[model samples]
Target: MFSIFNIHRMSVTKQLSFSFLVVIFIGSLLLSLPIAHCHNAPATTYLDHLFTAVSMVCVTGLSVFPVAEVYNGFGQVISMFLMQIGGLGLVTLISISYFVLNRKMSLRDQNLLQSAITYDSANNLKSYLFTIYRVTLIIESICALLLMIDFIPRYGLSHGIFNSLFLAISAFCNAGFDNLGGSSLQHFQTNTLVNLVIAFLIISGGLGFMVWRDLYHAARHFFRSKPRRLRAFAKQLNNHTLLVLETTAVLLILGTALSWLLEASNPKTIGQLSLAKQGLVSFFQTVTMRTAGFSTINYAQAENSTNLVYIIQMMIGGSPGGTAGGMKVTVVAVLFLLLKSEVRGQTQVTYRFRTVPRKIIRQTLVVLIFFFSVLLTAYLLLLEFEPHLSPFALFFEATSALATVGVSMDITTKLSTVGRIIIMVLMFIGRVGPITVIMALLQNRRREVTYAKTDIILG
Candidate 1:
């Protein structure tokens, strides 16, 4: 599954994959220099900075530093930049920007970009990427303005602007690196304005641009607020987008309720909090755990059941073509649909009255299987190294790292050097995802020119 000599003569996808890792590694190394030299850096170490940088660039949000306390403005800024690039996804950025600048993307480059972002090759790549950037910037800008209203009075003008912008980007990118580290929004958990604004950003970001575009068109029909009729234009909503959006909404609401119930009885968790705060925290937790790594409460001390909920949420993660990571809600939906079809003894899986293609069903199954395998293997490895850690903790950490959710059982700081390295690798792979990584590896090789058909007995 791994080879060293195949580094050269790699396909465009493989080269792009290699370049992404290099970019992250080099960018992090360069950014860490200031942190290593800074007087305020917390117990600074090379590996610590490297791990933090990898996590940030991966948009995983798991951290060794307390964030607000550990580094000065400079370090935080570096992290902000990394998260922006990571969340935007390097391939999307480069391809769109290159096309914008009138640069030609070779066929190989086109393939690389498509594979990296999980977009179909048949789509208008340049236009789609450009739309993604424009929509993202516009949404982030609006979120910043709304957030500034809350942050300005509290933190004052300059600091407020910085915080608002940073938070907006973090939220929209689903990066979860907060400036309010140790304070952890504990004081303002009930603040509806801040909480809802952040939640909106996280949801919108994770929803994927394709879905947003569909929803935007769908929303236009109701501008007059005449509820009786669905506008003719409303029929334009793509089945795929609708399915993904519906699944995401269901998961968010259901996961929030489940988490609240699980933690409601634990005094150390959300038990002591007010109803409003509890609701706000629950909403935020549910949204963040899926892909965004932010937490209003101490995740390390979360009840075992709460951690279990989080692990499940992390595994579901975000939608396709979004900054958020995971096996993806759409994939999960496809698998369920496949299962339903199998149980019914139907030849084809159907959803929302639309029949799913066999190729798509096969792809979804492969993705889920690969995702679970990677997650389970990582969990087992962690257990081998740290036998004393609870199974739930190990599972949570693995899921968080693999899903790029950045939630932790607070075991990160206590991890040995080897454990940290393992985490770093997991974060990298998590962001790129197992499917993409495997595809990248296989991209260079041609399929067998002619293959003999083989017959196998059914189980």
Candidate 2:
């Protein structure tokens, strides 16, 4: 007979996947309770509750029902809790619990933690886990305080504080669930303070914990040493940090500029707003499209060009080891570099004078192929189930779900039961990652025989 402790014997990928599924199941049960619903709200089905639970636990905010209307305060809190667990990750939470209980982690436990968080080694696991929690707390606390400045006066003390905290967690987690009715942050489109605060939170969260740690150390070193030269400070940063920062900055600027250009003449989106306000909306959309689901404009009414732009942005998503989801910025960066190398007739992919390993290139290609395969399969299934929706609309929704971006173009509520289920599975897979799923299912077996390789003709 196997015991719960035997879970430690499972492979890291399986352990992590199983942990996420267990959490989602537990969340579903809790949300299905009668108290989770509003008193006057119509009777809700179990499947809907389960769907909402999965969405929250996956931190993919595609809800079958409007969260604000259907869930009461208790339910909303439950949703927030689920988001926290999902954002921090199940393995991280379990490690935190062990720390709180003063339980010494075994070698197997450390291996599990390392694999779950994709940490390179067990040597710095403790410090890394501590940093993750500490940074999350500090960032979320500051964001909540900043948000309270705007929310308190508007929604009153209790509700405002609750909303502030909820939004803070949701924003930092990239969960994108809001109780401010169904319009999202449309009312605050032009509010500089609110938009900027949320945008910063989202970007910080999406940058990944490793980047945050590097930046923090770099800042500390600069401040402590009082470096007289800028070069000294620049030397403190690593290549990974530089790459992530540069890629993120470029994506934000390009996404914002393209969105503005695409929607400038459209009456439904940024056209009606003043030039300054339009710029603000465009900037917000760019930030949110990176896997944070909050939106300032009606995405459903967005021009086809704008939708196409968002599809690309959403698919690229945030950095690895971050709260946000999608194929990841690093993966895309590797792919771009590989293409550039090939175009230049080079055999090795190099960035910033550093050669990217062949293993990394192969891994990126595998992830891309798996991502597209899943995306195509889901799109085909959705087309069969929802023949009424436009192809772009369905593709957008499918991409949003697979990216765990939670930004639907008004198609979520209209999805059929099967469609919703498909989206749920996609959200789970997206959050867990296609690679993780593949690893979980297939143990890494070593090949017993070596064979000669044959080359196939290429374009």
Candidate 3:
């Protein structure tokens, strides 16, 4: 019986692992289909298609090809659809659709969904999926409407509508590819309406659906019934939600301020704009810097200080369970809280009136370590092949690609085939997540009790 149970568990894990891999692989295959030729589309390369497909399907936004010049309507449409699926999270989408079809989700499906959303309790899985799907459609629709007001006049009704929808999906998914062209949003750097709408969409999307659900429930209770009673009865809200909100606000405001100050004197940067425009551009940059992928100004023209700030923000992406990728805001929050507790000599790390588990702290440490190791290794390897590029540029590109942030310094086009391949791997690793990869590869071994114990002295 024990052997059978072990075998079953292994089978389930393997099945899930392969399913996840296939989603990405097939997504790339679909994206690579030949369509109307564009400037960025070379004669033909399977590796290019694989990389582009992976980037789109992963919602990482890192692209070897300039989106505006390379992909046609058909290819762009496929990429957009892939981004939507990737942003919604493949597991979450599958689980929700399964539920809507009146089918029972197996325990394995539930487990995978739980992992995908990082839900603490199994009981809330159904509610969580429903909320995710509902909110995603609602928010994206509203964002599209607002964006249409900006896009329609500039590009005409047909192009405007399509552009609005593409951008809405792109921003909400946190995928940075823009059909607006190679300079990113430089053409609209002074367009307050377009910039603001895009920023709002990106912000809404970056704040994971879990946080949206929490806020929705909180608001519903506030308006509907015995609000006081509900508030009193409610225990601690999810730590994940609080962390997401707080970290998001901090990153946006601080990132904006830092970028504005850093680029205030640069002729080619934000200094050329009026204070109001500068503020708007800075705010928009902040929104896109953390994995949204859109940019109002030329990132290449930005000061080194600004690029560094952007890199840090990109490396610490929005939240877990969102379209954005990075080490994640929650991980950074937990790590800081852990440090605070240790410095204060406290035995427990607490945030938002709740105690954090040691397991979470350990996980945060592991995530940070894995992120650095992978990024460093990739950066070093790329340097060996492309000795002409600046180290900072290589490091910046590696981290941005690994975190799935689409910002670039224009070196992407100059990279050798090998360099591009290395980045493709980083994007995949970024999307699948270092932790998930670790889990999939590591064997699950049981530990036995030992009779002897020994201690070693430490300084």
Best by lDDT: 2
TM-score per candidate, in order?
0.88, 0.93, 0.88
* Order of candidate numbers by lDDT, starting with the best: 2, 1, 3
Query: In model 2, how large is the Cα lDDT of residue 223?
Result: 83
Kindly give the number of clashing pairs for every candidate.
0, 0, 0
Residue-pair clashes, model 3: 0
- lDDT string for model 3 (199-251, tens) is 88787877877677677766666666664565532433466776787788888
Residue 102, model 1, lDDT: 68
For model 2, residues 1-459, the per-residue Cα lDDT tens digits are 977677766656666777788888888888888888898887778888888877887777888767878888998898988998888774465565467657666776566456545565446776788878889999999999999999999999999899999999999998888889888898898899999999998998899887887778788888888535667777788877788898999999999999999998998887888999889999999999998889899888988889899999999999877798888898899999989999999989998899998767767788888889999999999999999887889999999989988888898878889998999989998888654744442344446687899999988
Whole-model lDDT per candidate? 0.77, 0.84, 0.76
Query: Residue 115 lDDT in model 1?
Result: 62
Report model 3's TM-score to 2 decimal places.
0.88
Order of models, best TM-score first: 2, 1, 3
**Residue-level lDDT for 252 in candidate 3:** 85
User: Which stretches of candidate 3 lie above 4 Å from their native place?
Assistant: 1-17, 36-44, 96-112, 124-127, 225-237, 435-459
State each model's C-alpha RMSD to the native.
Answer: 4.0, 2.4, 4.3
